[model samples]
Target: MALNKKPVKGMKDILPEEMQIRDYAISVIKETYGKFGFTSIETPCAESIANLTSKQGGDNEKLLFKVLKRGEKLDVAGAASEEDVVDFGLRYDLTVPLVRYYSAHSAQLPSPFKALQIGNVWRADNPQRGRYRQFMQCDIDILGEASNLAEIELILATTTTLGKLGFKGFEIRINDRRLLKAMAAYSGFPEEAYDSVFITLDKMDKIGPEGVKTELLENGFGESCVERYLELYQGLEKAEDGVAYLADMLKGVAETSVTDNLREIIDSVQATKTAGFEMVFDATLVRGMSYYTGTIFEIAIPEFGGSCGGGGRYDAMVGKFTGKEVPACGFSIGFERIIMLLLENGFQIPDRPKKIACLVEKGVEGQALCDVIAKAQAMRETGSQVLVVRMNKNKKFQKEQLMAEGYAEFEEFYKEGLRN
Candidate 1:
């Protein structure tokens, strides 16, 4: 059988055009985050199955791509369960591996370590427009910081990076896990049922309030709880400031500080942000990750009509690896999605070096080639991007292709003098 040339399902071969944007975006991300004191770090793409399934990743754990035992350890025929045969899995996201990395390196790293990690993650999810089973995730996380400063800095850094990438007028929809629980609690939901209620509430954008109500009622929740739970959303629509309204409503049910801290984060970002984005309180926002203990946020771009990326505070996740809790929070950009949007919009890299192509006539060697090579090198040293290649017979078509690759100026060399 002929070898298949296509990539496996849910994966893709990035073409040169898209790779250019991806490379530029990564440079911008690293430069912007680095300015905010985040140091670059790396972790293995594969992690132990035990840590991946520690219940911190929520729905992503279900989508893990497990790796079977290797060589002598392989006992698929005699294994009674998956655990008996599988030992590791591809990381579903960066946060889990980051926490594990921090647990092992905390002794040598600085307190409140800020890390910038960019890598591929795998999930056996249904591939869609911008989502792939295998895709890149760009994450910035801060560990060992117990104050709202972490949240504030994270929001500012992420938004500034997006703005540098030419994203504007986007929405940073903010919410708190505590507020979600507090709303459910005040609405008379059982403590154990908060997750179930949240699972339905998360669908509000898709199914609408009536759909959420029907689902909640069908799931055996009290109609009164559903009514009261949704009533808060109704009030939020009319309130000038939803965060203040929620703060007042959840006064005694939730801690005063949770709402206060969240409000302060929104105000701080709005006041100091150098980006063209809005920070709005979204009580209905429930980041799927159960590990998020406090402020949760998602970036909404009007073009995507869905979340571009998101993250939140997960103070207790490190405790699962070590015995003691450490404060941690992260924000991940939907890397693949951002690349897709930029490609769709025909985005161009700003201030790029002038690209020039030098095509040498076939069989033109000796000092003529040496002169051409010397000229290209000199141009490169002067900050020009030069591509030197043997001239193709189809010179016009070759120039057209080179032009598409951002090579606007071209020089042709033959036995005679060079022609531009």
Candidate 2:
């Protein structure tokens, strides 16, 4: 009798049929990222326990999934304190681990190195609609630069990448945390405002304009600050589109260098000129991350209830590793979520690259079997997903049965054909 086995909660499987869309999204990311001089790099899935926690600061610490330590004493300890013994863990996000890698390798890299990575990340969060315990991130980062151009470059790369992924009617919302902090200070909420200021601002969209005002007042924000913040969010919604919004926000709510950064980003985006792109300057935007130092951004698609991906300037992540402050900024697309959205919306995926698929007959002629296997492998050499027939087969009815197995596209050569 077979024992029952299934995936643990919060973790999921990637089935074969689903890989078609996943592969399509990844290809778009890599192609668009590469066009921007971004190169691929991968980090180990397991990272030291201390590294992940320290960078995210306090806000995102709750999502980490710990790994138990192993030893002869493991049987005793692992069973009892399952959470405590886990000294290492699957990464929560690609950015933290990448900072460690870049810090370790920056000497061999050029200024403002751009990295494009496609990999899985795990988070231990309550499962809900469009949320998961584990997912993949397609991230792009520019390290060793403090200039705002990195932000602009990130927008171009992300927008083009999403465009290739079959997304339209989406806007990239840019905000400066410094601007948010300033608004809070200006409102006379000062120290107390930090408590729930961003938490309220983050919900400006979902809570409606009046709801945010009520929530902010309840959070102890003065009438002045609440009014300003509300006005900012309201102006953003009316700004025509992303580019138009950026223009309006630059004139309306943005203060300090945040305004300059927004304008420069607009100019860089226009001069660089990627097709089918829009950029919005959203003043009310306050992201979830605690590490963002300068500019911050979120990717919003109407199809998805919330953002598809987001990231911002740390300018200090590398310092956590090397103890030397370094300017770094990056953005990551929630690979699993976007793929889910694409699937849900019934977006047309590209055709499988290689048309040939083989289904072999078991106990068939040895020479013919080897010939079929070799041809399949040869196609894979030029970049095809080749799946070999492994299970036992009844040759008598196999060919007729294989029509539904995706082998109709292949040029069929049977054992009997070779025997002739």
Best by lDDT: 1
State residue 45's C-alpha deviation in candidate 2, in Å. Answer: 2.0
Worst 10 residues of 2 by lDDT: 245-254
Per-residue accuracy of model 2 over 171-264 as CA lDDT, tens digit each: 7878777777765654556665574777877776788789888987886667887786566556656666544454444444445467667678
In model 1, the runs with Cα more than 4 Å from the true position are 416-420
Pairs with steric clashes in candidate 2: 67-86, 68-86, 242-279
lDDT of 2: 0.75
Candidate models: Cα lDDT each: 0.94, 0.75
lDDT of 2 at 24: 77
Q: Give each model a TM-score.
A: 0.98, 0.82
